[model samples]
Target: MFIAGDGAGIGGAKAAALAGKIAALDIACDLDRLTAGDRNAAARPLRRRLVKERAARPFIDSAYPPYAAALAPQDATIVCRCEEVTAGDIRHMAGLGCLGPNQTKAFGRAGMGPCQGRYCGLTVTHLLSEANGLSPDQTGHYRIRPPIKPVTLAEIAAMAAPEAIEKSKRSNVSTQVNG
Candidate 1:
């Protein structure tokens, strides 16, 4: 499987778009939709653009490093606001031999909140890394669990009902016609 954008470590919209294009070209070549030569020809420009987009990251990082407060928050400071997990709590987990963010969940529910680690994943990783004397790579990220919203029984029933299906089709047609 081809991973692109932030998953591939290339951030920013333009860079992600370029990465996506490159992946698409490679996938097309693999599927024989395009020859290897054609794929390379198409990807050359995308790679150049991706490089240019990534080049600015160093300057931006140097210009504006992470906030010290975020990197080293007070013990009482809530790092994972959704779960109300404190920086000190994460440190305590590390002291207890919690090696990574995933382990932190068992210790204090740090990455088990509604956001599922989107907001606090990096901070938790950093805290664990620092406390355990491990690199961020070694103090790995959360094993993501997708957030599930509470669904009502009526919602489930509506999904399978023929009347609901007919209503949905009519609504779609109305929206299309009105637009």
Candidate 2:
């Protein structure tokens, strides 16, 4: 636990070099001692600190770069991976006078995928809004019709609950909708 840096009255390049070497050697010796120990320190139970729900966010957010330098899916990259539509494609639609997200969706087929509009809707809206100089609210996302499927009585019956079937039988709740 003894520090060897009595740097007082010691001046010039030679003393500076000696001091640096001594410091480096001291650090190296400490590292050797630590490594040579029983290594049982790691076997000790970890002291877990209780973190509040809101307190965790600052630690998580600090790991990211500053807002301006933060990374995001780039502009020409394929954003709607489901439909294989690039951000540039949606932007190009905007350039061609495509007004809103739905228009971009219709033109580029970006939001029409297995996940319906959920997957690509946000990316399409952001790109479309940015490209056309409109707000996100203005560039409205695609109108999602349910997970595109042929609705038949048999299909409905298979998926419907027993309670729903009995309730329907008791009342005229029309399950059919005009496709």
Q: Per-residue lDDT tens digits of candidate 2, residues 32-52?
A: 753423323321221111122
What TM-scores do the predictions have?
0.73, 0.44
Best by TM-score: 1
Q: Model 1 compared with the native: what TM-score?
A: 0.73
Clashes of each: 0, 0
Q: What is the C-alpha lDDT of each candidate?
A: 0.88, 0.61
By TM-score, how accurate is candidate 2? 0.44
